[model samples]
Target: MVTNGTYERGDLFDPNCGTRLILDRIGDKWTALAVLRLQHGPLRFTELRDGIGSVAPKVLTQTLRRLERDGLLTREVFAEVPPRVVYDLTPMGRSLIGPLTAVSDWAEEHINAITTAQGQYDAGS
Candidate 1:
């Protein structure tokens, strides 16, 4: 679906397209958590890790790198005794907060039903 070195209208629906790549990045649980945390304000690496609890340092590093590479967030390093680094969402990433919040709301509303269905399916199995 590339006409002039850009994806056309239906490129997102194509299986062998870049859309899946970007989706895989943002669709990740860790990525979602990181985005949610950064929505409030910029935070240091440790702050992000602590806020998004249970994530390993290495995994969080990978998620942050991917988000930075995708132009969703910016990473700034400060010259200090410990060389502090902070992460903040760019305009594009900020724009995603509304949609992500809607998804979060939907999940919160449906979680009970989803768990019930899962329990039923497990029992039936």
Candidate 2:
């Protein structure tokens, strides 16, 4: 726990803290993609799978479950002739969009430079 004049925050850097667990969730590539896809609006399971192409169904399911467990997203199930499920971001998840967008923008902006550096490192190795 963090103690200050008037504010308190979780100690993210602590080895045993939940912060690292949280990071493990959002730091995942699939999680990032899923979050971004849901930013536009809610989508069904198939829609999410199709949008996040090449992801195994099981992996996607696990990712969705993890996000929901963390309270980052909501899963709604509807009863019909055929069962239907949809996923959407929660307020906490929506709050992440801007930061993730900034990260995406930065990656796009620096991709070329990063690739060049990778090439140089690979050549030297």
| Top model number, lDDT | 1
Provide the clashing-pair count of each candidate structure: 0, 0
* Global CA lDDT computed for model 1: 0.91
lDDT tens readout by residue for model 2, 1-125:
43464234567887766567778888899999999999999999999999989999999999999999989999999997699999999999999899889999999999999999999999999
Q: Which ten residues in a row have the lowest lDDT in candidate 1?
A: 1-10
CA-RMSD of model 2? 3.4
List where candidate 2 sits over 4 angstroms from the true fold: 1-11
Query: Candidate 1's residue-wise lDDT over 1-125, tens digit each?
Result: 56778865566777887677778887899999999999999999999999999999999999999999989999999999889899999999998899889989999999999999999999999
Candidate 1 residue-wise lDDT at 78: 94
Range of the 10 consecutive residues with the lowest summed lDDT in candidate 2: 1-10
TM-score of 2: 0.89
